[model samples]
Target chain A: MNTSKTQKHRADLLVSCVHDRAPDLIPALEAEVKRRGLEGEVKVVEAGCRGFCSMGPVLLIQPDGTFYVNVQPADVPEMVEETLVKGRVVERMTYQEPSSHACALYEDISFYSKQHRIVLRNCGMLNPASVEEYIAVGGYEAVGKALFDMTPEGVIEEVKKAGLRGRGGAGFAAARKWETGRKAEGDIKYVLANGDEGDPNCFMDRALMEADPHSILEGMIIGAYAMDAHQGYIYIPYEHTLSVKTMRNAIESARAYGLIGEDILGSGFDFEVEVRVGAHSFVGGESTALMHAIEGTVSEPRPKHIHTTEVGLWGKPTCLNNVKTWNLVPEIIGKGAEWFASIGTEKSTGTQVFSLAGKINNVGLAEVPMGTTIRELIFDVGGGIPNGREFKAIQIGGPSGGAVPASLLDMPMDYETLEEAGSMMGTGGVVVLDDRSCVIDVARYFLDFLKDQSCGKCSSCREGIRYMLEMLTNITEGKGKMSDLEVLERMGKSVKISSMCGLGKSVPNPVLSTLRHFRDEYVAHIEDHKCPAGVCKALIEHYINDQCNGCGLCLRKCPQDAITGEKKELHTIDAEKCIQCGVCFDVCRFDAVGVR
Target chain B: MPKLKSLDELKKLREQLQGDIKARTDSSTTITVGMGTCGIAAGARETMHAILAELESRGMDTHVTTVGCIGMCSKEPLVDIQQGDEPRVTYGNVNTEMVPRMIEEHLVQGNMVDEWVVGRVEG
Candidate 1:
């Protein structure tokens, strides 16, 4: 009566999110598993980031999909007994929804359920360092498929069908670049993977580079195969040491497996790849500037009279792609182009990995389909703004990219839609802004950033951005004329049109978009000399209201001894001494601190 | 780490390694054999090897492991099978020859062998 035995699988206790906080659990889990005599039955895999950064040191038991958050070495024994050995979930270890107070599994969690991970598919599933594990999860098969199964033109056609675009915010068609490189007359063409991410809060590229490095290599190999290019360079900022290290390791592993070197998969295709570290700059992610850096020159953009796809990297046809774009290549090839195109919108196909930062409740990485509205990305996937504050704006794209106001929350996040809204999907970095965030101040922040980063190749970028920054600064300090707004818009537009590279072209997006959408906020500052958000120091004054119960917390926190009050009575802020620091506003439990 | 020569070779390797990483995926069935000295002396090691090879040939992905004896010396080589949310079924006096049918009836068919199964425990 006995039936056939099933192919035996191993149970893996994945110590997910193996970053700075993982060393303790990683070592303890391995040693404890061995000591408990469960090594054969259970495997301790140190996985990459699960994208839920705040709730990490997470543990996931595979074959059962039981996820435990905030696990520590001290809890390892009980976890090993109650979950690993006993074959059940430790209910207390699961993640609880902040509002609902309800516990849910990883798949059912709102944060994860809303996300459709394509680029991040392998990020937390396996040990990134192990090529065997990568292969086990269907890695590097794309190279075989690309080189053996499809011709170069066939591959390009497939990508065109997929409608893959540049994810570094430019939104250029990836297949168009590859086709140009393939058709261009060159014997020494190159494929470049741009990991030199420069957005203020964007780490999606770095995360992809660090977490699943083999995927990057796999994608690059496929790119090289498609473009008829042999040499490749992964240009990462020097500061991303972990990403650099993992990429190098992944390259070596792929090379050893003959996935990267000559005659890959026994086909006649010969390709090799290496890592290139450059001086970190916001402009470094731009295709032209990245090529200049790779050529051992100062990292600055060159005019695109002749495209890089035709002549680049020492006068050879070169194709450069963002790390996220390169990461998606393998997935597209492995799963057909039609499958990828089916996910996102018609024009913008495939999913985008958006790094949710700034004032959001869930400050993590989310890969959602392209057609997902900004509302879904911010509220459904990103868990909305923190502390029940009203959403004022979201700075999407990057420093050079524009901010969308709460009015456009329903705007679908595709290249065309975001661009039409005066924003670029700058590598999918979404910085949420609450009511407290000043649009003028936010624009000033980006202008200040661009002033330092712009290469000065175009006078419009150098002078235009500097003047834009000064005007925004003056406006924030309650010193703007109505005439200044017109000049600012004209200059922002000139910089957008005149700049040679991506840096200057899109540099003034923040100011222009804010002026376009939140013009009343600027008028509030210019005419009334008041910062509605109470941020500009020169325009606002702080005082304690009658609601103050004299907690004395603000008195202790005030650096200038501006606050003085009795322990049980309403406190007062000395107007002469108050520097408008707003420390009292942050510290007071009661709604006592008022800005006027 | 010799380079794979062709697509077929890579495909073969993928198919082979898929089994190795199955435990790392969403495989819910687990097969545990008693590997204590008494069990090993009763040819449990051979039975375990037979089960592994059989599973590979059958392309069935499940978790296979070994545990210490529970003092049932006479009923040596006790093999326990547990599927997802299913009660663990223990088969007594299991040998190499009994593995194929145990896999068929218990794992593939989802039924306990009437005469062979000695005990059961909560999943």
Candidate 2:
């Protein structure tokens, strides 16, 4: 009601309207703007996630590029009165350096300053619902060039020259797959974008899809032109409700704008895209299983005697690429192969978007060029391990990927380098672990995940994973003999060699990599029946230390009520009644609880 | 919302849209007011309006905009001004009356208000 004369102008306030905490903050911002009678001069526009989840409820002031974090509804009035009406920055809301107490701009923050944004270039910068915003940032230009100026062979050639590999895990050459589909003997060819991101702690693909859906769509359209495919499908997991909605909207808008559907851009290249949502199945991310799911069949992978590029979806030549892989097509087509090749390593060209999560200070998506060392990714970009804990290991890739020890922190993170270090670059999920994490328990956790996700098609995968899980369970339970380690090694190798699909083949990665690196932890568990990190419940016990001031906080928080003491006296845990839940260890604020 | 017919049309559209973006995002001189909660509480909105009114009165082409807090909440109502390739000068606790002097000295005469300047961002 208090509309000012200047309120009709384009966005004056750009609130980060992400799914996390923006919903509650938006109304407060609007109400304050209205109450202050500055509505006419200040227009609020809701944008996507700004990648700084730890400091969410973030706001970015335009024109001057001032960034605010940890904003609350209560601070709205003064923000409007001081900043909006008086043209003054409310210093209390600005991001300050933790140690120096100096203010930092968004570009100057180390969390955003050190990273290169290729796949995530558009994230936090544009409104995903608006197609014009996508186009203004050069979204569909690559598809136009591919359709009008370049031939199909030229497009494929450009991709090959860029040295772009599949980002889905295997690092297969994307252009080679496109060439296969182009040359495959089939009248009806298909191109698929695999959005079924199954890796735990990885949300890079989901972020790209939800934030910049058009980029993926544009990439797929170009791929369709290169592979001579008439139809394309974007297979996203159903749990990704925002991604599905944004992608479906993006496809519709593109169709309505003549970027897709029949006679795209009047270039006579008729290609259409459909959004398919499937239930989350870990094994369903496999190419063959994905294609089978698209065909309305059971989501299970078959033997790959023939490559999917030659024999795929509905028994036709289907060119399937990961969401991130397809997203790169537009950039390569727009900037040329040489420009893309100049960014990363010689073999692995371009930047990799990593979901940096677990035990790190900054937990979000980071895009860095290939050949970036694990030390830089973890310490520099990820803000190092949280709470001053010593870095122990990083579980690179996902459940199927291997763990890299602290000694290998300097190793460059590329497909071949990670593989040579006994780990595969599985979808770029970098889960850092600290000294408190038990390596044996980490291996057992991943093995348990794989055992559940395996398709159970082959005996090597089904039986081998079962046996491995049993041994790991025994080791964690402090019931394992020394000879079981040999059995684990033999069965792990057999699974890797005899499994029918990638899921089965890579299931032993966590076990084998942990064995190869942290065998001492396993020996400690087997021989001395001791969990070094105090993680295994059966091998460890909790006790109150001398530091306890008898705060009674731990006693109240204990679910089993095993701890008892006076109000101001050190508490003792009844070892028989204690379930070793570690609640006391976690709740004790005085560093009094000890586990050994 | 007609479909772009050809490559030339697409390029032309991009140029037009880019012109609009550049008008707002790029300029020879940029004046930014921090409008985050801290900035607003400290009277940054008033400072921004003053700058906007001054620019409007002078009919200056200099781009004026608002950014979120830059983590100096202790010094509320921060203003940053940049001319050409020169370093951006950050002014702390800026008030409404400082707008005209900033525009006249920094924008017109190319002389920075050094006493008010708190920090400098390297170009």
Candidate 3:
């Protein structure tokens, strides 16, 4: 189809009123539209995500592509009146730098400038529900190609040639798994899309599934063809109602178009997919556990001897890949393997999608080439650490993944570099921590999560992680002995070697890597009983500066009523009652509250 | 919708589809909302409805479309306007109130509203 005619029109305006968690703005904006009585003049439509989230609630006016930042309900009035009413740009509210004196567009922003998106190509572009829209943008063409043009073996060969690796954390070769399942001796080979994304603070898969369900469906259909599998399953958490509905709609749409179910595109292949809702068990994220859950068994994982590709899901050759991984297959086939391989590093091919979250200025989803440096992601793309706070450390992967200290901040992001930096690119949960973060406290938090998540299948993972958690807890509480560090290390090593699955094996990552890099902080906790970041409440003390105006604000705000002072006098914090909720620090107007 | 048989016949059908898509014309404004799961969860559906209702009330020709997540979830209920030289303008965190003024300002006039513009990429 010629896209030029469609492109010839005036630039379409794209805006995100849904972001910033302000849903009421939609009605307010609509009411403002009616109130203004300019009903037919400007076309205001809701588009999917615009991929630039840090500056939300963000506004993008098209043709000019002017990006507005920090938009609110109040700002909407002036924005509609001055710019929309008068046809003049809102100069002050637009994203402008104090030093450059130049307004920056979305592409001009450091956050979105450095990324390339192929798998996510249709995310912000097309109407997900419209088959025609998807078709217009060359969606399902790969499925068409696979069904009409390529053989099962040919499709698998093309995927292998693409060098596509799983984005679902295991970086396993996508083609190799397909080949294994294809060759496996079973009439009931299953292709399962594990959308049961349980990694804390990671929502990339759920976002993709919800945003572009068809892409995942297309990929799964193509995978089924390649693997010669007739049945497929999409496993997502029951809480993901949006994803479930979207996936169901996409499946229905595919079925309606004859893209799925029996004799697809006259290829004489019969395949269909079922969307399975998983219970919210952290262990259900595990492959074995997921398979068990699908089988209506307990959501706990069992010891894995045989690979699932050979024997899985009722003793069938079952292939389980993450949502993001399967979403890329059709693209690889359509664009060719060489095109896919050319984008990312040689070893870890294809772009990886990440949820660039936490304490960072650009908290959005990012898809950079596999080898994009962490410096680029954190500083260039993420707009560096927020609040002028110094960059301390970044936690990659989830709780099971380790944190990369400042020393390795420059390391390129891929499977290997993260592994070398004592972190794993597990499911692409990149959390940037600023200077205010206490390393010990962060370690303790991760350990707490791991302790809760660990499936008790292995004694080393269950009891050993419990022990490490206790030690880390002791250190964070300022009651740890100097020898506790060595004991924690010894225990962490044993857990790493003796654990069952990835969750168990890598549970020691936070404790071990923190001890490896930030041992001095641990020593400070043990020897001096000091939290350098002033985050550890047990070791830190709260005080009121002499600058306090004796305003009762802190005293009132303090849940414990820790502060006591007379008018115009310095305030004091009663240590016994102070709960360290940091409310006083937040409420104090005179900078009187001090944490040390 | 007959189940297509034979890969070659499917190929021919695909070619026919190519022609059909190219020859189509609506001239109606296509409002593609970034209602990806994140957007809807963020409330793009209501934003979409507000725009659709605005166009419908005025009896103006408009086609409201929904797309997947654009990765920038922080700014959602994202709206993309495609009407006539100008690229698509994306408004983040949109609602019913901004619709009338947006229609008056940008839809009728050829001018772009900078305040409602979230992030515009030339590429």
Candidate 4:
């Protein structure tokens, strides 16, 4: 055996090293160590993409849960000199504030104090690229326990007892699907990981897959074992590079370790995993359309006659769950049903991961126990709205989800509650809105996205979405009739009822939700022919206030030279030439710009 | 390839690990470098390397290891130090240049570097 290998094996420090997004720092740091003669004392390792994207570069100190932030190239010396040399700490750079002093712990930072990470537990802990690191942290031990210790029926019972419903918006009980798949009359059953997360501002599933690929793999393997499925496929988006690479490496590593492909853990069950990447069409995220795309056909949905559990993917008993749902399986099994059931609300066990973005002080991924109030997510975890802006509305669940007005901030964030609030918990993308955001414009943006993404297989989806888009466009453009509201509601219902897939079924969410919560915004646009938030260009005009010294910056920067004013005087916009471009508004730094 | 049949067998594995780690006990200084994915992405690798190198160069018996992210990615290259009942100090935005002084002043002399410590957590 190699002496270096022996030394490595003997190293007493249990280090799970991860550099959030900039993995290139590993080799460079390793080089710095060797150049300075600190080679054998430290072991350098590379890992996965931690889910926190907004904070770009971060590192976590373990065992005692010390966290540090905003680390740059220059601070390394002070860190090493103070902490490592004399066995004392350099308090200034710590993640946790000196308790007896003014600084705060990482948890006290309002951004993280409210989060309850479950699906994302290993994201920033273990190296995503290493199978061994995953194993050391009890990654595949669940598969071992499930395959040998428990019967398939026992596994299903445990999951049922755990109350782990699907996290991918549907909230279907995961164990029941397995039970149904197991009961279906078929020689071959299939397990599929639905990685088609095409929602706007939704990155939780992708982040989970990218950060902890093996956990997902282990979960899928366990699921396959429970359902007697021999093959699994991960239908990921073609554009998701990090998740694809991580998942592929994980699958290969599992195969090599005899954890997959043939008689895993010496149990007489075999499973193989495959990957299928799809294009940018949002319709492909729908189950039937995704299956059609997988079957070498154009992505389109078929009516639900034979359930996927009964016959799917070229006429076989198939079971498909989203990436987040698959990611939760190992945790449920490893921690035991009761422990898993202990988290979150009674109806919604465990935590739900959300991509917290838009106008918030902290924009990143957050995992809070289910039934966490939107107020807590936005105010406490998101650090409130940026620039002290008043909280306006929060659009939950992407384009097919509804908007929650500030009045409902105390509403719990779960499938049933959000649905009652006119929003489905579709993938947990909460885009926090500030007072500056126009509710009508926000609805319009989601409508535009849905309109372009509709597969056009059903007449209601195609025609209805197109009509809704036209009406919303007309409303925003100050050309809508009062009767347009009636048309929009009628078309939205037709699309919801006659749609072939979830994509079409939920397409009217933004419009319906906005109408429910902020019908005033739509009325303002239609009746007054004005945008309340002054966001829609056709309804608003921009002008520099008299406070402007006519710096000439605004005049010169105007696209069409709309500003007509002499130097050292307030500028006036020529309404004829203005085009309401708002260039003059943006260029004035003296708080002279006003949009009306 | 066999399941742990009895408690005795599990106990043996524990004993083997204990014997392997006998030399390292009562480590005076515990320095943890954040190596979570976000931390790693944020240049944690460099911070970790510099910390270890500085420790070895100063001949300090500090135990340097990697840990997971505490979910603050805005500040990467995190370092946590615990020494002799002194409050645990955390350093953020760590890089190579800060390592030597951190090792010399903080680890060796037990003098806290006020400029480098960004936070502290209670035991």
lDDT values, one for every candidate: 0.84, 0.84, 0.75, 0.74
Worst lDDT window (10 residues) for model 3 chain A? A2-11
- Tens-place lDDT per residue, model 2, A1-596, is 11122212323466664476656677888888888786756666566666766677778765546677888877888877766665566788987543335453577677788899888887777778878768766779898999989999999999999999999999999999899889999899999999999988888888888888998999999999998898999999899999899999999888877898888878999998898988788899999999988988889999888988889999999999999999999999999999999998999999998888888888888899999999998887787877678899999989889999999999999999999888888899988889889887888888888888988989999989888989999999999999999999998999999998899989999999999999999999999999988899999999998899998998899999999999888789999999998989888889899988
Every candidate's DockQ is 0.26, 0.21, 0.07, 0.05
- The regions of model 2 sitting more than 4 angstroms off are A1-12, A87-104, B19-28, B32-62, B66-81, B87-123
The TM-scores of all predictions, comma-separated, are: 0.89, 0.88, 0.80, 0.80
Report model 4's TM-score to 2 decimal places: 0.80
Candidate ordering by lDDT (highest first): 1, 2, 3, 4
Residue-by-residue lDDT tens digits, candidate 4, A1-596: 11110112112212222334444555555665466455665344443444445554554433333444555545555544333332234466554321223232444565566688778877766667776556645567778778778888888898898898887777888988889998999898889999888888888777788778887788888888888889999998888877788889888877776777877766777889988887757778777888888888998888887789888887898989988888888888778999988988787888888888898876789889989999998887777777666899999998999899999989998888899999988888989888878887888898888878887878888888778888888999999988888778877888888777888889898999898899888899999988878789999988767788878888889889778788898788888888876677656788798888
True contacts kept of each: 0.46, 0.21, 0.11, 0.01
Q: What docking grade does candidate 4 earn?
A: incorrect
Best by TM-score: 1
- Tell me the tens digit of each residue's lDDT in model 3 across B1-123: 654455455455544443222212244466677746677677665666676556545545455555556778888878877765356788887776887777667676757678988865442
Better of 1 and 2 by lDDT: 1
Deviation from truth (RMSD, Å), model 1: 5.2
Q: Model 2: which docking level applies?
A: incorrect
Question: Between 2 and 4, whose lDDT is larger?
Answer: 2
Span of 10 residues, lowest total lDDT, candidate 2 chain A = A1-10
Off by over 4 Å in 1: A1-10, B27-59, B63-103, B110-123
**Residue by residue across A493-537, what tens digits does model 1's lDDT show?**
888888788788888899999999999999999999999988999
Q: What is the TM-score of chain B alone in each candidate?
A: 0.84, 0.77, 0.71, 0.75
Residue-wise lDDT of candidate 3 within A1-596, one digit each (tens)? 33122222223344453643566655666677668764543444444565656666666654345567766667777777654443345777776542235463666765566778776766655445555556555677788788777899999999888888888787888889889889998777899999988878887887787667888888898998888789999998999887798789888877876778888866688889989987876668888899988998888877778989998898789999998888898888788888988987888988988888888877888888898888888877777776567898988888878889888877888898888878899899977887778988887888787778777889999998778878888888989999998888888888898888888888888888888889999999999999888888888887888888887888777878777888777788898888888888878777778888
Docking class of 3: incorrect
